[model samples]
Target: MYRYDEFDRRFVNGRVEEFRDQVQRRLAGELTEDEFRPLRLMNGVYLQLHAYMLRVAIPYGTLSSAKLRGLAHIARRYDKGYGHFTTRQNIQFNWIRLEDVPDILDDLAKVELHAIQTSGNCIRNVSADHFASAARDELADPRVYAEILRQWSSLHPEFTYLPRKFKIAVSGSTHDRAAIQVHDIGLQIVENAAGERGFTVYVGGGLGRTPMVAKKVREFLPESELLSYCEAILRVYNQFGRRDNKYKARVKILLHEAGLDEVRRQVEEEYEDIKSRDALTLPHDEIDAIAAYFAPPAFETLPERSETLERAKVVDTALADFVARNLAPHRSPGYGIVTVSLKSVGSVPGDATAEQMEAIADLAERYSFDELRVSHEQNLVLPHVRLDDVPALFAELQKAGVATGNAGLITDSICCPGLDYCSLANARSIPLAQRISERFADLSRQHEIGDLKIKISGCINACGHHHVAHIGILGVDRKGEEFYQITLGGSGDETCSIGSIVGRGFSSDDIVDAIETVVNTYIAQRSSPEEPFLAFFRRVGEAPFKEALYGAAPAAA
Candidate 1:
């Protein structure tokens, strides 16, 4: 993790002080809610359904053991006993008092974390693969670059107040675990024909009312030129992105309107003009310095799978399922990337209790060299756990309710706080998710379903990533009542596409049955268990699921 330099320390402290004064002014009746709204948003505070929600940035999803402990402390002290990890790789406290935000941020700052840029219409937090440093096929660690972008974009005087919120992601591996295709700017670290590593840049991608996959702007930009190239892109967007209509204010809208060729031309012109600026380009030494911060720890070489782990897998079904699903391939020989699923049976999808957070921190220290990652799917990942310690680790995780064996199963859902926490939401997402999970709690049924992603978004902001789930569920308000809409064939991978609405929306009470209908339809239509729900849906259109879901033929329904 990158330590806060003096400049960082000073800037964060200054922002905290400024916000503290702003809160005082608002309380003193000098500023109305409308007047103070944007001010508070800039500090990552939101006035939600019942209380204020504070989003704290976990930069690039990296957290040290001590920092993880700090977050646990916040959960214990200010809000409820848990916190929700979000798709943007940030954490949200759903029940926070307005006055406690400053104190919360102060606590966060003590452990090199803060909520700066977690919200606001400026550039938001940059994300990357949760398994960046430990993944098997990574060409280079992406967090080093993400950290660089964090410093460069934080309170950037030129681009701080942009047309809309901007998000960027970097993927060091060929696999797109970070969902880079759905970001405003996506960078894939690639090695060129000349054998030098750099970035393949994609711009103007986003998921909202209008979802798009970013277009490639640069094939292989030199690593040193990342800052300058990124600045050029942002500068172009800020100068020409629409502001008249809020709906058309995002960079994606601009790209759509201007066409990719025109956008590329403008970006190139800007890049050419700024390429020679000394301060804009990151020097090789500076890149080296940044890289040093995320260098992999010393890994010991050992045999692949230890005897104890094999014996545990033979005995415990839970341990076996965890080893099979939660563990990912690691770059180092005897190690693996282990994900701690926060979506246990009846818990909030992305939430972690204070005790669970502490347990995860301890596990990271014991098995993963004190390094931890918060995945975009709301799971905690120990990116370099030795395979030999799998059994004992799984045992510890079971004790803490962190050993759920459903990573991409129906139970492993991405859900928003919905009406329970988000004021923008029209319906309750958590209860619906819980209902669906309980209905599909049969491990055999879920495994038979196979790698199905069910994402629930309370409203159309797509915060829960409903647009990309294999079975996307969106909660909507129809009059005073709540309804849920389903989308089919959506994905957040190399074959990225926004899901199409399957049929009419279902009532809140009717949603679980509707989901069951969809799943049962997949079970009937799938060729085999090897065929995923999305694959089956894509193969057979909405006809099967729609008929099954509506209990009538397509024309009749």
Candidate 2:
């Protein structure tokens, strides 16, 4: 993890002081809400339906134990006793007071964390795969580039007010774990034919009302020119992107209207002029220095397989299931990556209580390497745990109620804090998510159904990324009634695609049954459980599922 240098500490402290003054002005009636809206947003403070919310950045989702403790302290001392981890790899404290925000930020700065650029989004937090440095299939650590982008984009005057909020994601592996294809800018780190590392750049991908998979704009952009190329793309969007209507202000909308070829041409034209600037051209030493901070941890030589872990699994079936679901392959020999699932049985999807946070922080520091990662899936990761420690870690996690072996299962749903808290939401999402989770609470049933992703959104804002889930649900309000729309065949991996809606919407009372019907249809239509829900949907299209959900097979044409 990157520690704050003198410059970083100074910058954060200065911003804290500035926000403190702004908050005082607003409270004292010297500034009105209209005048303070942008300022508050710039500081990641939002006045939601129930209370003020503060979104703190977790740069690339990497955190030291100290930082995790600091967040837990904030959750306990400042607002409610829990915090919500978002799909964007950030955390939002939902019940913050407007007056205490500066103090909260000061506390965050004590641990080298801040909420700056987390909202109103100059470029937002640069996210990456949670398995960045530890994944067995990683091409490079995406955090190196993510951190670089974070530094370059932080408070950039030129991009401070773009056409709309911008987001960028970087992936260091062939798999799109970071959902890069749904970002304003997506960078896939790869090696060229000549063995030189570079990026396959994609632009204009997003998932609001106008969901889209980003189009590749460059086949191979040298690593040295990453910042320059990103700047070029942003310049094109800023110059030609829609601004008259906030609804169509995203880069995805601009690309949809103007066409990818034209957008590429504009970016290339811009790149030609700015590519050689000293500020944009990254030197080998600078790149290496940043990468050095994210180097893999030292490992002890040991047998690849742990006999003790194997014995523990053989004796305990639940332990075996958890080992299978929660553990991911690590690049280091005799090591594994553990996901601490936040989607426990019936609790909120992405929430972690103060005690839970403290427990996780202790686990990471003790078993993993004093470091942890917040996954975009709303899970925490111990990226370098020894295989021998797996059993002990699983036991500790189970005791904490944070260990539900439902990773990538139906119960492991991605949900937003819906109408319950968000002013922008049209309907309640958490209750529906809780309902579905409870319906699929059976361990055997969840394992029988096999790898399925359910994503729910309260509205079209798509904060929960409903567009790319295998089973996507959207909550809409019609005449003050909550109606749910279901989408199928969407995925956010190497083969990313936006899902298509099945048919008419269902009432809240009827939605769970509708989802169950789809699952049953999938089971019947699939070749086997091995064929997974997504593959089955793709193999047969949505007709069978639609027929099952709505009614019997349609009458002969």
Candidate 3:
């Protein structure tokens, strides 16, 4: 993790005091609600349907045990007993009091965490692969660059207010775990034929009312020019992105209106002017210094497999199931990357109680080198756990009630704080997610479904990333009644594609059955159990599933 320097400490403390005064003004009636809106948003506070919501940034999803404890303290002292982890790898407290925000910000600053840029039309928290340095196939730690971008973009005067909010994601692995393709800007670390490292840059990818996958802007931009290239892209967007209509303000909309070729041309032209500047080019030593902060943890020499884990699994079927669903191969031998599923059956997806947060902090300190990661999938990750300690960790996790072994399964869905809290939401999202999770509570059933991603959003803002899910569900209000629209064949991997709507929307009562029907239809259509839901759906388009949902697609007449 990147430690805050003296300058960082001063900057954060200054912002805390600044926001403290703003909050005091609002409470004292010196500032009206409308006047306080922009100030509050700049500090990551939102007035939701029921109460104020505070979103705190977890830079690149990395957290120290101390930082985790700090968040737990906030959850316990400030708001409700739990916080919601979002798709962007940030956390939101939904029941915050308006006057308590300053104190919360002060607590966050003490732990080197803040709500800065977690909201608003500034560069939001830069996201990266949660399995950054620990993944077996990662070319480099994307967090090194993510941290760099965070430092560069924080309070940047030039980008403080864009046409709309901007998001950037980076991935150091061949696999797109960070869902880079769906970001405003996506950078994938790649090596050229000459073995020099660079990035494959994708620009203007986003999902909302109008969803579009980013287009490749630069095939291979040298690593040294990362900042220059990113600046150039931002400059181009700022220059021409829409300002009249908020709906058409995003860079994705700009790219759609102005062709990709023209956008690339302008970005390249801007880059040519800026690339030669020493301030923009990253020096080798600076890159190395940043990377040194993320060097691998010390490891005792051991075999690849853990005999202890194997033996325990032989006796405990639950452990076996957990290992199968919740574990990922680590870059280090004799170690495993364990994903603690926050999406327990019937629970709100991506939410963790203060007690559970503290318990996870303890686990991270005791068994995972005092570091934890928040996955984009709304799960907590123990990134460097020794395989030998798996059984004990599993037991502790079981006690914490987060030992659900559904990582990429049906129950492990991505959802947003919909009508329950979000004022913009037209219908409730949590209840639907809960119902679906309980519907597929059986471990055997989830495993049989295999690598399915069900994402739900309360509205078209796409906060839950439903557009990229294998089974995307969007809640809408039809004549004051809650209904859901389903989209199938969407995915957020390397081969990214937007999902197509199956047919008409389903009533809240019938939505779960509709989802089950789609799943059953997939099972029936799959050639074998080995075929995954996504693969089968892709092989045979949405026709079969659509037919199963709305009966044969009205014979072409």
Candidate 4:
């Protein structure tokens, strides 16, 4: 992980100190809630249903063991004994007192973490593939570019206040785990036919009220012109983006209204103007300096695979299941990328107990390279674990109640803190997620379902990424009652698509059964067990799912 340079340390400390005074002023009656709203949002603080919620950024979802401990400390001492990991690869301390927050910021700064850019209509945290340097299939570590963007966008004077929040993601892998297609600016690192690396840029993709997959405005953008090109895109949006309506302010809306061809033309015009500016054109030496911060750790050469691991899997069926389901192939021989499941049965989808966090930190320090990653699936990753250390790591995980052996299966769902915490919520997302998880608790059954993603959002804000789930559930308010709308065939990867609504929504109590019926329908309609839920849905379309949910025919109902 990148340590804070001198400038970083000073800038973060200065922000904390500035916010501390702002908080004091609000407490002393010098500032009203109206006055303090934007100030608090600037610091990543939101007033939820009951109390204030503080969101802390984990840049590119990378963290040190020490930073994990620092978060656990915050969960224990300041708020509740648990923290909720979010779909954006950030964590939220849900129950925070207004006065204790500055102190929390101070503690986070000690570990090179901050809430800066986590909220408030500026450039948000830049995310990358969690398996960055560790993935066997990745081109390079995407965090290098993510970090460069982070540094460049942090309080940039010109872009401090955009029409709305802008999200950027960098994917250095062939597989689009970072969901680059759904971001405001999606950069997929690619090599040209000449074998030189750069980015394939996508613009205007988002989920929320109007869901659209970004268009490929640029087939290939050179590495040296990254900043200048980004500036071009932002400049077009900034100058022409709508400010009359918040819902219509995003770049996606601009692209939709302007059309891709015109948007590309405007961006290219802007790019030509600023392409050679000395400040915007990043030099090779500077990129090298940034990449150095993300170089792979010292990995020892070992046998291709661990015999001990294979032997243990032969006896311990549970460990074997976990090993098969929770591990990913690593670039290094005899190493595996381990996903620590936060989705335990009956617990909230992404909530981690303080003790569990500490245990994970300890495990990372001992077995993995003292590093942790937060995935968009709301799971944690130990990116560089030795193959031989599998059993011990899984055992420790089991002890902490954090081992759920479900990743990308039905139970491992991305969900939001809906009616319980978020004021924008029309229905409770957590309870619905819990009911679905319990209904699908049988690991073998989930395996049969095979790599299904169920995402639930409290409202249309799409915090749960319901737009991308194989089975997407959106909660709505129906005459003061909780109801949920279901969608099918949505995905967040390279083949990104906005899910279609099946039909009318079911009441909260009936929603779980509706989801089960949808799954059962897919099972029966699928060509084979080998075919995943999304593939079968795309093959057959939403007709079967609708018939299953609303009876053989809605006319009969």
Candidate 5:
């Protein structure tokens, strides 16, 4: 994790005091609600339907045990007893009081955390693969670049207020775990034919009312010129991106209106002008300096497989199931990456209680090198757990009620704080997600359905990333009643594609059953048990699933 320097400490403390003043003004009636809107938003505060919501940034989803403890303290002292982990790898406290925000910000600053850029049109927290350094297939730690972008973009005067909010993600592995394709800017670290590292830059990818897989603007941008190329893209977007209509203000819309070729041309032209700037080009020494912060932990040599874990699994089926579903292969020998599923059956998808947070933080400190990661999938990750310690960790996790073994399964869905909290939402997302989770609560049934991602959003904002889910559900208000729309075959991995709508929307009562019908249809349609739901859906398009959901068309008369 990147430690905050003295300057960082000063900067964060200064911002805290600044916001404290603004908050005091608002409370003292010196600033009206309308006047306080942008100021509050810039500080990552939102006035939701029920109460004020505070979103704290977990940059690149990295957190130390101390930071985790700090958040747990906030959850316990400030708002409700729990906080919601979002799809962007940030956390949200939904029941915040207006006057308490300054004190909360002060507390956050003490832990070197803040809500800055977690909201607003500024380049929001630069996210990366949660398993960046730990993944077996990573070419490099993407967080090194993410941290660089964090430093470069924080309070950047030039790009502070874009036409609309911007999101950027980086993936270091061949697999796109960060969902880079659905970001405003996506960077994939790659090695060229000559073995030099660079980035495959994709621009204009986003999901909202208009979902798009990013266009490949550059085949390979030199690693040294990463900042220059990115600056060029932002400049092009800022120059021509729409300002009149907020609906069409996104860079994705700009790319759609202006052809990809023209956009690429403009970007290249801008890059040519700026590439030579000394400030933009990253030196090898600076890159190494940034990377030194993320060097691998001191690892012990041991066998690849853990005999202790194997023996425990032989006796405990729960342990066997957890190992099968929740663990990922680690880059280090005799170690594994453990994903703590926050989506327990019948619970909110991403809500973690303060007690659970503290428990996990303690476990991370004891077993996983004192580091934890928040995944874009709304789960917590123990990135470097020794395989030999798996049984003990599993037992502790079970005691904490977070030992649900459904990492990529149906119950482990990505959901948003919909109508339950979000004022912009048309339907309640939490209830729907909870119902679906309970519907497929059986671990065996979920494993059988294999690697299915069900993402739900209360509205078209796509906060839950429903557009790229295997089963995408978007809630809409029809004549003041909630109706759920379903889209099938969407995915967010390397082979990214937007899902196509199946047919008419379903009533809230029927939505869960409709999802089950789709799952059952996939199970029956699949050639074998090994065929995942996504593969089956892709093999035979949405026709079969649509027919199953909406029923077959009338026989030709």
Candidate 6:
């Protein structure tokens, strides 16, 4: 929701013009593929398996109706009729023409959006809880800080090309919906003993071939020191992070090699050096200005009208389910945050057609404050919808095929594009997700199971965030055959830990059945319906599910 200032506007326009020329030069044979690769990557263009893919940054997953419409325009005109919203709170078009990328960036810039920092080995888009400013229990709006970081990191001379890609996430609430623990830098908004707002910064967390929860580098950094402290962490990483091998290039690997104490010492030293520089430390006025950009729009003062809401609840069971599952607590009295589930049964988890995007844009403009947010789970959020209008909104969303009565339910899965669109994948993830979703098509059964996170990654990169899911499924190739491996007891919250791998892998034919067996085992062993699958699993361990998947045969063990 932060409007582009004059300087920001000029910078993006200039970059678009520069990329346009670069595209022309590449087409004219003035530059080789290798020579032009970095330039194109800087503009968020990638040469994928079948075509060029353009990734557009949705900073902190925040967007206005105008910006959403711009994305829909790109999807309709430049590439296919649909675009994929990624787990990083970005959107990707898989079938872009190389020559059209500059045009796309130009169009995005017009809407105060850009593709900068969406790709390459630089600080990527900063993500936060989609319901940031609107959340009832929010300590502070993380996007206000995320936007500041986005501007500071954009085309930053020193961090333009790090050893590998870096990601950052922030959460202002106790529940870590943004999965902060698995990012390269995780900032949790906290209060000090004096009751002033600050950040608890974590560093070196990532999921790839190696998955590790970030270590706490700073206990409580003042609001004014956020930028400088982050810069300190990046400076240390850029200076000492491994560049010897691609596999060893990430800051996480560097942290692993150097140990947390050394990394912490280096960052602290760097922070001390940069802390006094005015260029690094944001002024109080500037911080207030940034915070003002996210101030909630005026809402008509009204009491909670349970009479109207209860009438709809009495008549419509589906609406009641949606009201319970889709609505989130809001800071405003009569308003609530709503997540419009794109994971309708038998549909791709994150793919939104141009029409759906337009519809969502319209809904945001009409019912909310023209504000939309792309969630880390690949869904959209209208963060300021009124509770009294829930019935009408539900009807519109249901007509658009974006309504599904599962938010934290078992079937509401998080998945990667996987082997279908990603060249890096070893096996297919979408089909696997589809199979699992179909297996739990019975809404009552899914509700009975309750609050299970099924995250699937195509390969070891963990793009699907498999390591953070309560039920993590990883797809790997064994002797040219696709097999799926299961990991249990993982979480991405205040209590973060990498999942431990279960005994063995399951064949593609057996994965759905294996997941069913795991669920059924939880159902049979659970003490009560209130016990979630994760709680039950944590209490009983993986022994029951392991036995169910691989029978009593000694080889199964």
Cα RMSD (angstroms) for every candidate in the order listed? 1.6, 1.6, 1.3, 1.2, 1.6, 1.5
lDDT of 5 at 51: 97
True-structure RMSD for candidate 6: 1.5
lDDT of 1 by residue, 1-557 (tens): 68888998998988888998898899889999999999999999998878888999999999989999999999999988889999999999888888888888888888988888988888899999998988877889999999999888988999889998999999998788899889999999999999998999999888878887788888899998898899989999999999898788999999999999999999988888897556588888988999998888999987776677788899888788888889988888888899999988888898998998999999999999999999999888999888888888999998998899999889999998888878788889999989888999988888888898999999988899999989999888899999988998888876777888877898988889888888888887789878878788888988888778765655331
Error of 6 at 490 (Å): 1.7
Q: Which lDDT tens digits does candidate 6 get at residues 254-282? A: 89999999999999888989965566877
Clash number for each model: 0, 0, 0, 0, 0, 0
lDDT of each: 0.89, 0.92, 0.93, 0.92, 0.93, 0.88
Instruction: Compose the digit string of candidate 5's lDDT tens values, residues 1-557.
Output: 89999989999989988988999998899999999999999999999999999999999999999999999999999988999999898999999998899899999888889999998888999999999899999999999999999999999999999998999999999999999999999999999999999999999999999999999999899999999998999999888999999999999999999999999999999999996556699999999999999988999998998999999999999999999999999999999999999999999999999999999999999999999999999999999999999999999999999999999999999999999999999999999999999889988888888989999999999999999999999999999999999989899999999998888888999999999999999999899999988888889997888778766772221
Per-prediction TM-score: 0.97, 0.98, 0.99, 0.99, 0.99, 0.97
Across 1-557, the per-residue lDDT of candidate 2 in tens digits comes to: 78888999999999999999999999999999999999999999999998999999999999999999999999999978999999999999999999999999999999999999888948999999999989888999999999999999999988999878999999999887999999999999999999999999999899989999999999999999999999999899888888899889999998999999999999998898896456689999999999889877778897888998999999988889998899988887799999899998778999999999999999998999999999888889999999999989988998788878888999999999999999999889999999999999999999899999999999999998899999999999989999989989999998999998988888999999999988888887789768988888878897897678766663331
Stretches > 4 Å off in candidate 1? 551-557
For model 1, give the 10-residue run with minimal summed lDDT: 548-557
Candidate 2, RMSD to the unseen true structure: 1.6
Model 4 misses residue 94 by how many Å?
0.8
- In model 2, which regions exceed 4 Å deviation? 276-279, 552-557
Cα lDDT for residue 344, model 3? 89
In candidate 4, which residue ranges exceed 4 Å CA deviation? 555-557
Model 5 deviation from the true structure expressed as Cα RMSD, one decimal place: 1.6
Poorest lDDT segment (10 consecutive residues) of candidate 5: 548-557
Error of 3 at 52 (Å): 0.2
